[model samples]
Target: MDKHTIMQYFEWYLPADSQHWKRLAEDAEHLSQIGIGMVWMPPAFKATGLNDVGYGIYDLYDLGEFDQKGTIPTKYGTKDDYLEAIQALKQHGIRPIADIVLNHKAGGDELETFQVRKMNPTNRQEALSEPYEIQGWTGFTFPGRQKQYSDFNWHWYHFDGLDYDALHEETGIYQIVGDNKGWADQNQVDTENGNYDYLMFDDIDFKHPDVVAHLKEWAQWFLETTGVTGFRLDAVKHISEDFMADFIAYAKTLQPELYAFGEFWKDDIDTTLRYLDGTNYQYDLVDVGLHMNLYQASQNGADYDLTTIFDGSLVQIKPQSSVTFVENHDTQAGQALQSKVEDWFKPIAYGLILLRQEGLPCVFYGDYYGIEGDFAQPSFQEDLDKLLYLRQHYVYGQQTDYFDHPNCIAWTQSGDEEHPQSLAVVLSNSEAGWKRLDMGTLNAGKTFVDYLGRCADKIVIEEDGWASFPVQGGSISAWIEESI
Candidate 1:
């Protein structure tokens, strides 16, 4: 089997014209030709409205099928459109991955009075007020659909906490006070801000047996309905670790080969590793630590040490379970986690992630199709295609690394028996430099050239199958045989 690359198929600021699914269907063949094995699609269910990016989920059963949230279609499109997109992707040999937001639910249909205590937002372990009755938007009747799929009516008891008190017209993190109600155990979630369970809207209490059973049933229904081969679990750090493991396990029972990954979103490697361990390695995790390193390197430029790039990265610690990414919807400009990688270092960052044989690399949609909204940017498709082509063709076999420099580093791939290809990649963050790397003594006099067209140098290998590969300052150059 050939190597697989995952593409995050949606950006944060996509136009709400309800044509995303159609667009995806049209581009399915192109994506398959580019060697994309999987596509992480945005949330297809009905959210607050057409403007909502599907994160503020209103009803999981309504996949743009019912007349809820003031619209019959989601930000993407109708349920039929979504299923057609999935069929198109599958027809093109691509596995469509559904983005599942099981952390919280937004845009409830009604308000209900419930007793709660306001907790400190910074430290959720500390209560700021005594238990009091407050009307909150914790009632979700789904009146528009009239419970078509499931007769599950969400009440205050279904949630552990909420943000707004509708009765007092106040805004705060209010934890519902009742029998066995509170945040998940500290060990089950990240230790940031005391407890990071309550992120936004009505936090789903995973301990509720009904909630678990319903979610499991919904997973089975979703699999049968959409035929998605995988899931991109969102905001997993704010959810119960055990529940997450169980959810992935349960989903796999319905579809055993279902690929699953989570968004831990922690810059600390220890936290990420701990989460992976806590979940019993049931699913892979996005390497947020590596992204932070890339961001810092982009910001610091030449001053940054290239040798320590993957020092604390999940790819370095747990390569088998790390989903390496350059940028995503959350890391794009104007988003909450606004740490957009600098434009100048984007190619270098992408080269490091795409060409290396470490973790599973993911391509961002914003970088390929260009971002929309206030901070729009042009597409980097041309340069990315070059790297993607090389990744699909030549990035195979045993790997070699040369990280002895502060700015310039190089690596080589001794092509396997089936794929008789060789690649030598060199990158420099400071000044132009060259590295004499050994590509094995199989082809002593083969000519090589820069595939990226950055440097117009063509050199023949020596008797020992070693050549000096050149790279321009602040750029990357991938060298391959000229006669391939």
Candidate 2:
């Protein structure tokens, strides 16, 4: 966790204005000043259209460079604008983490007649249709790009399957079956549908040597061209675990210290851990289980056990590799998969992720800045910022957790020698409560103030180093040893 804080640079419905890169570049200094060490930018490569949100990737070599998809730039900005933004962020001392969507590709140049077989929706291993010629959108000539970066071209041979048949106007999961051509083994995934590898569009066949080769080549070029220091892999569950491990190994040749993570997005921690193990622990994963716990706590409130917050969570198991977050683009209001943590409990969730010294915390853009969509959600910027401020300036020490209570949990961090300010964090899902805990003999008579303003008072420690700290109902309080 070299960079303690990271920001998912874009949300799902970020305005299709080409000036997003410019604004981000300008805000680099401001973000760094506010303790954001890195930004995980959306995919910079040219997508299907200017409105694709950078996920429906077309040409990896095309980073809004050529006149592809009737636009010179992607949803964010042009290639030059993207490079400038990365440079600007670098100037402000923030490492830009590029989004790598290697799992699948979409928006082909045209349809090609290819032999394919439909896999059963419930069981992908069971084929319902025989291999037959069908017109599918797998041709990606990238005419606009003119193969500028790499001469490698994508055709039906490059992919293992296509989901949609344009001639028939039908959609079905088709696996390109042959001696070795087909969807990557679904056995590696954990799902009721046997495997969830086929998420959207033309899924890439990682088993193919050419596909893997092109990906590795493009990664090198992307690093050299954009100078991104890290990566945020998209839809990694669809790709082979071994391929991901090899990709990281190959990428490290260019950037040895590259901080990379994948969106495994599992319901349980076991699957995520298995994926990490399968990849030989090459990168970290998003702590989705913690997010689910937060959502449950928001729903159940006092009924939810406060002590079980870290149960079945990556942060509790492997603290260092766990990138913790409250809500991201997917969990925002009215997204593809919406499970918004209640606004009332947002501060509490942020407090938990930021105050505790476990995982690398990622503050979502939608959370920091009010979400923009059909229904706008209130921003918890102020509360989250203060916690981040403490994280940057005052959060340093040996942690002591008091998770005995069901509705309330408290912790005290013995101040490190570097910073003489110890922190005591307390929260409750139910009602107002107080914790009389020892913050170590280092502070016997020091006074502590709740920066959250929940208590509206400061408590002085007694001679034995114990003090009664209070918090409001359904709220969290972070007490800092008040500056003497």
- Using TM-score, give the best candidate's number: 1
Backbone clashes, each candidate: 0, 0
Pairing residues by index, what is the TM-score of model 1? 0.99
Superposed model 1: Cα runs more than 4 Å off: none
Q: Residues 1-484, candidate 2, lDDT per residue (tens digit)?
A: 2237999988888889898999899999989888899899988888889998888888899888899988998999988899999999999889899999887788898888878898898877778988877788888888887878888877787777678977788899888766688666765555547667677888887888888888888888889888999999887787788888999989999998898988888868888888888998899998989999999999999999999999999999988779998888788877776889999999999888888789999999988988766868877788877988878866677889889899989998776767668889999999899888888777888899998888888899989889888989999999987773
Model 2 TM-score is: 0.97
lDDT of 1 by residue, 127-193 (tens): 9999999998888999988878789999999899999998889999999989889999999888788
Report lDDT (CA) for all predictions: 0.92, 0.85
Q: Give per-residue lDDT, candidate 2, residue 31.
A: 91
* Structural similarity to truth (TM-score) of each candidate: 0.99, 0.97
Local error of candidate 2 at residue 225 (angstroms) = 0.3
Which portions of model 2 show Cα errors greater than 4 Å? 1-3
